[model samples]
Target chain A: MVAKLKDQMTPAERASALARGEKVDRLPCNPNIANGAARIYGCKISEFNTNAKALAEAQIAVYRRFGSDSIRIFTDLFTCAEAMGAKAILPEDNTADLLEPAISDLSQIDRLRPVDPYKDGRLPVQVEAMKYLVDAIGTEAGCSVGVVGPFTNSFFLVQMEKALQLICKDPEAMHKLCRISLESCKAWAAVVMDMGLTPTISEPMSSCTVVSPRVFREFSLPYLKELVDFIKSRGRGVTMHVCGQTNKIWTDLADLGIAGMSIDNVASIRQCKESIGDQVKVLGNVDPGSVMYAGTPMDVRLATLECIRDGYDSPKGFVVMSGCSLPVETPVENIDMMMDTVREAGYPIDIEWVEAEIARCKQVLGK
Target chain B: MRTKEELLAELARCVVEMEDDSVADVAREYAEAGHDPKEGILNGLIIGMNQAADLYDQEEYYIPELLICSAAMYNGLDVLKPLLPQEKQENEQKIVIGVVQGDTHDIGKNLVKIMLEAAGFTMIDLGRDVPVERFVDAVRAENPQVVALSTLMSTSMQNMGRVVQLLEEAGLRQQVKIIIGGGPVSTAFARKIGADGYSVNATDAVHLVRELLGA
Candidate 1:
């Protein structure tokens, strides 16, 4: 068994020091565990998301087990949109599937109204979960709630293909939908901020892999900038996660004045560190599917070390995280290996040792 | 007063330019000019769709552009398809496709379907949130040349493999090629699940089907 390395500071202290550009005991690690928390807490996926107590208890359980730096409150990206009259099909053991969009046609744009976090759909459940988490572990570890970005939320209000079609065929209607979606986002963020938590934007649909950088510039960027500015105006820093290829818009994303960016595994972390590391804190991007969910412990250790090697010396800071939400079926041992690897290779990472270990892990894993 | 060549070129240009609202008028004009409807579809709309695919491959166009271009192609198809002699539509190669069970995200599946249709395969779309039994039933009913499964979530990825298993158990696996694609699926996962192939994108999906069916 690998001996555990002792941390010199609590997660909160480490996060504070890192924000202030000071040294800390270890590299902060957050594997973007969301649904997986329910598995750890021994509850059905449906209950874990809908019941605030279950959600909070599950997150606390995962944090206790993995000792990741942050308690991330995320159910799915569609919660806010679901609140605004979109129909979703909930499964007993999977995230809710959107059944019907709120505005199936642009002609129905008038039907969308800003959500009330406390009274609408599942936003209240999420807010209640945040309250429980903040009261329980807010002082010991950092906490953030996943808020869907305006552009992605807009698509949730309409069918995705129709929404993309509107980008070329009907820009005005697209803007109208996005304008209303932004209002829902702000309402949710305001609720989160009132509880003193950062609202991390998860914009899975806005990735360049789905839409071109030009589309992002015209449709997503302006709205994202407004959301980020609004968060900043509240005197809170914001982080963002875009789920697939983002290298095309690294500079544009950096220009948003975001404090941190969670890159997907599909994008090059090394390039991200080089291009925008000086501007924003770089977090991410181990392969959540191949490594964390499908591979063995050794594979997890190797990927974790590789991420630390690539991102450890960023000018702003770095947080080791999964490329996206950890699949609910990810083996617990793989997560243990990730945390162990991070703990073993704590701050002032020994480049020589990390390189050697990476080599050894690769050989053992036959990669 | 235009030549057949001029009409075909105009049809293709309308699609490539994403003239979704007007491509059908060009198709109707081609039909009114006593041109071959099949020629109008093959040399006109499909050619333009292929050009759009090439642009998507080159990153000169993206999803929004592809979606609109496909709309144009479909609009043109609506005008030209019924004008075809009945027997012409019967022998096209067929493929069954869907987003696997427990996953509802279908833009990727829709793109692949569009590309395959543009490439001339008749797609038996099961749509999203398809149960595993439905896949086996479709193969029994359609006898398609290929079965393509998709899922954006890793949790539902196992259902793709289940479909393969049920097909084999029903003694139907030998008749069709199985292909899978999506955000979390990989060639390694495809091989593990005994699928015939995996594609990384919609364009590649069309090529994979062709290669699998030896088309």
Candidate 2:
């Protein structure tokens, strides 16, 4: 049936239709969830962050309850960083943060070789959780796992401030730390793939729009290139989530052998489709905060439809997702709206809904 | 025999000095020169810091550069504070800033605080991960016109709502405008929690302060 639908559509039509973009049966809803789903299962964020089983169960339960298309398994950016030696601080009042350094000093890099994910800090726990998830629902249900990018891991290793300074003062030390971070991530990526899960890495700092594109290249790029290669060599799809305004390095990132790039609202999705849309999958640009948090479920549905509409034809890929992690306070119904939009709209859709959103834009343009 | 170049140089010098104590000099030099305090702020310090903010956005500048420049701007504002006419000085708004509980992400919050201070608001920084009670107590104690909350983690968003609710429960909501922004914070979330404003970056946060204060 999917092939038949693709036969009737344009290349963009085929891609969006497969993904259930607007004009298709309905849009695919695959928003990134951290520990937020834990609330749905009556689990604490602390439990959700530390215990892989609880985390997996809560994600599964939430996806099942909400009728979501995929269950994203990301327990904050500190998971892989922890395995590299950063201590995970799962606080009750906030997202899990790293408590210990992955490397206290550059000397520790030689001492801090990457361990097998199965034997490392919490990797086995995560793999076991994925295995449990696979056992319960299987791959037809769509399960995704997260790997922290080297730069973010390095951020935890020496703290964000110290890391940012080093980008300017000690580029070589930053590069070495990036390597360790990559080793840890590659280890997790290997394990997640073995468990039959799609691997996605979140590059929180690759956007010079956040840090510097130069720093991103000097401190982040080479190692990330290696991790991407590792994932591909394993025959798994590699999704890159570059948070913040990353238009500055969009082409650079797209050229890095990534299968998908998750973007925030800062960059125009259409522009992204035009630039790297053909090279890899493009998944996102939705202001998850606005539509998912402040707007009504219908608003989320409509805004998602708009994203799908704008993303109608891409090079090789498109996935409906929020520009960043879904806010913890995001109403579950809003998430459901995204899936519903995809399911309802099907594929090859556009901006009539955008007309309402564009009122602010119009006022800005004085049209 | 003051050269035009010398005067401009002095202007730059005083602008840096404005942040020295209370930014009184920032206000004073302009007031003495028969210039608008708002114009003085725009052309002199805010403009410079804004450039710094741009450099930050472009990766052309880093935190140390941002922090020290903001510090210099804040000091210039200090030197200008007492020198400004009483009306313009009094017109300067008061802003209350804090990092919500359970978040030790101080760099972004501190940057916003510095930006706000540079924008000439009397800032009461409650520091990082402040409890709800403290936010309430600080508000009651300082009676700031606006309350700005920062939280970098998705987990602390609930705390932000609690702080907003606490202010509302205390019947202080009407008197204080609430603004929130940080990594992991969305404008939608801010509106969902009944905050008056949200901005994506520190520059926007400073601009939002202007809008919230009706300046």
Candidate 3:
């Protein structure tokens, strides 16, 4: 049997203490398990996403099984866009797919309206799930609802190809679309806060892999600042996850006054910690695809240990997590190994042992 | 009254500058000047696209710039392609590409298609959310030298492997080289799925295809 490290505090207490600039038992670990929760609870992705009880129960099962630091509620990135009238294909066993944008042209932007969390598309499904989770296990762990950032939601409204073209062809129209998307985000986030859950922002399209930093500043940054300020004004801390290479915008994103930032595995967590560790808490970046889904238990252990060694000492704080959301088919044992490694390493991580183990693991995993 | 050299330079500049509206005018000017339509495409618009690709490789231009440049290239192609002899229209190397089933994110796939087309390869674009059967069928129908599969979603990534298996079952796997790419895909994944290769970005994909074809 593998040895497991004991937790000295509950997940909620650990998370709270970490945010308050205090330390506790072990490193707070969250693998961004969202749709993957369905697998743990034995439900199809479609059933889990549409049914509030299934969503909440699956999340609870994940929390119970992994003792993860947070319960994340997110059906897909297109939830807000779908609510605003974009069409999507909901597969029986996979996440929803966007079929067509709400408006094909920016001229039709005026036809779109802000989404009402209670009344829009699947937004209500997400809200109801949050309600159930908070009611059931609110005090035991941190709960967050993943909301699409304005830039990505705007792309969903007009399709990414059109949105990118609009950036060079019609700047004003792009801004108008983003503004509408921003309001939708605020409206949905306002309701999440009302339920006492943090709203984590996801802006996959804003990553440097997709757009230039110049474009990000012109198109995504301003709207993100406004949304982050709105969330902070409500006295809630917010975190952001941008799903590709984001090293170019670390300084820009850090300037947004966000409480924490989730780094994608493609980017270096060590560089992120060195650059912005003082300004914001760093949560990330195990390779969700290579290490979590395709790797073995030992690979997860090595990757988790390597992440801790690199990020454990950030001045602001660090929460070990997957580089992005785990693929639904990720082996449960790999996730368990991640938690077990964090438990064994515990707080006041031994740099020497970690360093040696990292080398050995890298050699064993052929990194 | 511009000379042939002057006309070609303007054609290239129009594409590099993303002058989509003016590129057609420049190509028409080139065509009227009796400059070889093939020279206009190969030396003019294609050169500009390669320059833009260089900027992209250097990170000076990103997807938006690349998209607009490609649009300009296509506009220029619209004017010059019709003037070319039928033999000039055919390219020796043909490649079929698509985003695998259950994934609609095609920005990467489209970029690869543009770069491959600009590099003088004939491309049969299967578009986004293409089924595995379609890929196998396209392989049988087109008999292209290479097949490219892409997906942004991990859930749909398995379909790439399924496509490979289907092609093998259909006895068409040995007929073409298979390459895979996307956000979650890695070289290891390419190897695991028995693909011929994987490239991280669109620019490298051109070189990968060339190398795979031994061109």
Candidate 4:
């Protein structure tokens, strides 16, 4: 068989053009990188979670090996919470968990001090690491730092039960804690955006699965818009990510002041592209757990192709990425297959080939 | 100051509104009024908790919301437990629930526990990071009709299949149904691991349990 053509532009150019709503040479591919990078560095997730130098090194290593459009500096979701007095429990191979809340009660919302990224919590480790990532690849790649959203960070600070209780019992206190968490988010973002990298806000708890659209409208959207505006004002770009069941909140999230948005696997990418593709940049969402971790490299290829077809058929501003965190045990060969499919089958996707492939998928999927 | 029915409605309302602080007070009032604590609990608190669970299934309520509502439910239960009559059943449908070994993320498991309890299932919650042997031991001890397993990590999902294998070897597979859930779990995964049922969210786990147990 004769070779098919690939998109001509570089990944960085494709990413930049797509973010600006300009024509892209092809879809930019950035598999969701986080603790997944630890596997590449041959270190425990605890090392990546605790040590700044290792994190920066591992992040860069994955960027080089995987050939993603963006180099992300997201280690875990609890750094800001750790900064604000919530303790983090770092496991040997898994991501960190909240050991204890800084303030057990809502009464302490007022007493909560601001997180200084350099001085407070684990945010400084990330800041120093991201500086290294940007220094290494400032011009060659897209650099973005990750942080949890306001609602989630607040959950870490007050614990989960109180976080939900205050929402109904005292909206004022919940909003207050969310705002404080946003400040921590902004403080962390301020340090990294200063290095000219975009900030990818992974706000999983703000999704419709965790909150009603009514609650999301009340709490997450305003704070996110403010986060976007603040980042843009600093002369940097912004990317938003919410992990699961984001379909309910996509229209509103797409309308935010962001350069790109990452939707998880549960949401329909085709609908997202059709509804808001003209408005903003969309990234993501293959099932990071099953397809990337459990399935074979061929599975990754098929998923990548399906995602590309879904995105390409809709509009121009879509970047193929994982739906959520790529598991720490995700196969390197699977990553390669995903990138290969993007390069081989994505650009100028053959209509007959995709149709044939879809039929085969339905047959293989036993539908 | 209020009648029993009004206090019951108020108890349910506090849970629907996520008023963890006030549900306990309403329970106390209902008890102080010479109202049947069983009636107050059944009519007031569980009703509200069931409403919250429904809302959770509908995605209108989340982990946090359900967490507080359950707290309120327990508060009311604490006031009513001593007065309630001993319950009787011919064959009690028991359930053993826990996060499978190597998984520390228990919020999903906790939600499942609350929802199952609200649905009136007797649950032996082994809690998070429970070893595989502990599950077999729990089954042997409790003789549960079902074992509901949970995990948020794909890495720990391997343990679910192992538990099923251990059960088969121990000859308990014929006696008990096994169910699985968590963020990374799907219907396909549950099938792969020999789990009898799978639910994506906490609320549906109750429905799954009810269906599996013929409840």
On lDDT, the candidate that comes out on top is: 3
Candidate 1 residue lDDT tens string, B1-215: 88899989999999888999989988888999899999999999999999999999998898888888898999999999898888846667999999998787888999999999989899999999899999999999999989999989988777988999999999999999999998887787788789999999999999999888787
Clashing pairs in 3: none
Off by over 4 Å in 2: A1-27, A48-52, A92-94, A103-111, A139-142, A348-367, B1-51, B57-93, B184-194, B211-215
TM-score of each: 0.95, 0.79, 0.96, 0.91
Question: What does the lDDT come to for candidate 3?
Answer: 0.90
Off by over 4 Å in 3: A4-6, A19-23, B88-91
lDDT of 4: 0.80
Best TM-score among the predictions, by candidate number? 3
1 or 3, greater by DockQ: 3
How much is A106 displaced in model 4, in angstroms?
3.7
- lDDT tens readout by residue for model 1, A1-367: 4876556787899988877878888899998788888889999889955799999889999988888888888888788889998987777977777888887667779878999999999888888988899988958987889899999998879887778888887899999988999999999999999987889998887898889998889989999999999999999989999988999998898899999999999888899999999999999998898678877788789989999999998998889999999899999988888888988997788999999999998888677
Residues A119-171, model 3: lDDT tens digits = 98888888888889999995888789998999999999998789899999999
Q: Give me candidate 3's TM-score against the actual structure.
A: 0.96
Alpha-carbon DockQ of candidate 2? 0.27
Best by DockQ: 3
> What TM-score would chain B receive for each of the candidates shown?
0.97, 0.74, 0.97, 0.94
DockQ of each: 0.66, 0.27, 0.77, 0.51
